[model samples]
Target: MADEAQQGQLVNDRYRLVRALGSGGMGRVWKAHDVQLDTHVAVKELLLPSGFSAPDRADLLERALREARSAARLRAHPNVVTVHDVTLVGGVPWIVMELVSGSTLQERLRVEHRLPVEEVAEVASALLRALGAAHAEGIVHRDVKPANVMLTEDGRILLADFGIALNEADDGLTGTGVVIGSMPYLSPERARGEKGGAPSDLFSLGTTLYEAVEGVSPFKRETKVGSQYAVAHASVPPPRHAGRLEPLIKGLMERDPDARLTVAGALELLAPAKPAPPPPVSPPPAFSPPAPEPPEPEPRPASAPGIRAAAAAPSESRPSTTRPAPARAASAGARIRAGGRTRRVPAPPPRRPLRGLVLFAAGAVLIAGGSYAAYQWTRTQYFVGVNDGHVAVFRGINQELGGTPLWEVETDHPEIELRYLPVYQRKQVEATITADGPDDARARAAQLALQASACAKNAGENGEDSVLTEEERLLTDRCGN
Candidate 1:
């Protein structure tokens, strides 16, 4: 015990780690052994990463501890993953959960693209069972999403990660005013800053089912405002492949939480129905229109009035359309005007071709960006690195080839660890910038850390810049020693 404690040690005098299961913006999750209990268990090491207000860190830690308590209260449910224990070691919370083996719905989506409606019905049943259990126990799994679901090897779906659960027994964990749930799956009531409940979980389940069959979120859009608007005001676009299950999906996703389908009602909806859905058409890429829809005006009709009017005339082929405009006067006059006279000008080289070409080039870029961003926003949640004038934490992973800034915080901590901050996304304000680029310290730290990781990968162990060695120094404050 003495030797083991000296070398990594057992957590809470019981669990000994065997191997890391995975790591994300949250700290590492490990497959571990419970020596005292004589069983295998899963352990999560939660960090208080640098960069959060003291109050938020405190609330976050308390809420995380509540995760164990909340899930444990629902241990009787087969679909709810069991929580065994939680321990505080060095200000980090170690969560001991049931050892379930299999892939996540998130990972499955990455491979299968979209699942059959039959399979999605099964998923919905599993999720509703878990939510029903939690709800019965007065616990709300506030952060439900595809990523939070675990599909076991033996064909069972388990609900995991209740870290931000709302426990009716205690409302203390909330009230920090931080919205901590994935935006795409966020219930409209919650998305609009209203209180959420069992109905909200059902709404999220509808989204997960939608994503499973449609391969896209019902309310997904390029920007936060657009997405929130979709969630709040815009109707969910019909799921082309949902077939008979469409009614249930829509019922669960009602904007008014009180009116959404109940867990019990959904169970009835999950019964195998008559007439299977037609074979799915290949899903369009994220940025592309789902089907041939009404065309957008070239150069984005919403923004450029001049370009829309200039481009509209020739396409409409109606001179009457031109007669109506102060919008078109300048472009027409510019094309035929003379300094002294309204003399005829040899049909000035057609400006439409040039305008169309430039518009296409510009529109192509935004469309491409929108597509990539939509995919990443809905399918893959982001990781944020904490930046305090102190040691750099695991900043490397945050620097992916193309990632979006989904959230931010104002903190004074030397370092803070948040297992899941991306879930609490604030709207993007892209207009502000400094000459140095991205006033976001996390962005800068991530870029620099990746540079360091790349250097180590190419130069080997003895390299001046090594991710592993520098990480140790940052954590230990032994830099330059």
Candidate 2:
């Protein structure tokens, strides 16, 4: 430990490097003391090898500055490391952050291999909440592996790195055509060279949570190549150790990014709100009308001479032109009671409101069917396209007349000059839109590409930076040949 202390020289004149915290491909980090402030801090310094040119060095320095600014903006959430100051020491950028005393998630996993279900849930819940906050700010932590997460003594999870984080509407200071991030946590679209978006971060978090619960990442591989392949094609198997949380864990880890849960959706799943009760159903209305009872026939009494003459006046003269009324025979009881008794039948009861009830039922059925059809269409609609040189997504376009474009993003690919088709395919519209400058058009095109790629790949909306990559260069060069 004493010899290790000798390795790092004091930084920024005020921070005295005491001991090494950790070392990595980027540089070495140390636990240091701020003599002026009389506080403990962690100082990270870059140590890029000698072969790099001066311009490359400058770019690296700029990246470091950007990273510092990003980390400072994160503030001091319980799950985040606080950035204090940034400076140049020994010609390399150095950052001072709060000294957190805890083991990294990677170290813990290395020793214990797997966390218990309860413990995993506790840790995951906190991490996810922190992620939700970051995502709301349009920040995507490109690297979300175990190594970057620190578990403090009080059992708090702290996300440690913002080196490769991409802020929404970035200024492109990180430059074009550069890919930086780990592979295991990469979503399929990202593995296929898509930008890592909010969904991508969720994918990484899913990987982390999967490891926390299952004792292994579902995409574990001995080599980066193998891991990339698994990420792209492997069907995420059901967790061997998952107990009751199996469905959630598997769902979060779905290869189709669209199928995976969003931050809001995931929160609801893990800590569900109170469910609403179903409404009461009314009984059907009675439809049939009541029947009337049968009525008895009645007989006429003898008429007076004057009344009979008046009744027969019109017919008496001509009467006899039609036919004389015939006398009907009757039984003794009927003749006796016929003159005194008369029976009447009650009019049929008014028709019940059966037609209205039938119409209402039919309307309800139509509503339910329409809703289901819309839902199915939404599930089927997917948007995939190139953005910022890589594939990006604009999810759930099928249910919508014009789907919600997740966001407008820049594409990473170089411009393709199409000559003849512009005239044939309505170039006038394109020309009018281009008044905003080619850059904006490119940005829109990139956004469209992302949406297209998302649909084609069935990925989610959290897209990566549309920076170019070594692989894309190789593939393009090879394909062009």
**Clash tally, candidates in order:** 8, 32
Which of the numbered candidates is closest to the native, going by highest lDDT? 1
lDDT of 2: 0.61
Writing each residue's lDDT as its tens digit, candidate 1 over 1-481 gives: 4223333457878888876666544466777888987988988877544566887787688777876576787777889788888788877778889987666787555433565676778888889988998888888887688888988766778998775676654332245554656677888887777777778888988988889877677777898677777777777788888877898898888877778889888888777656978898997868855464343333323477887688557664545644554543343223343563343323335556788999999999999999778656533322233444321323122323446543443322232222111111100011111111223334533433433343333345435544455443322211111
TM-score of each: 0.52, 0.52
Candidate lDDT values, in order:
0.64, 0.61
Model 1 Cα RMSD, Å? 24.3
Q: Candidate 2: misplaced stretches above 4 Å?
A: 1-8, 46-57, 169-178, 272-481
After superposing candidate 1 on the true structure, give the runs of residues whose Cα lies further than 4 Å from its correct spot.
1-9, 24-27, 37-39, 47-52, 169-176, 220-229, 273-481
Worst 10 residues of 1 by lDDT: 420-429
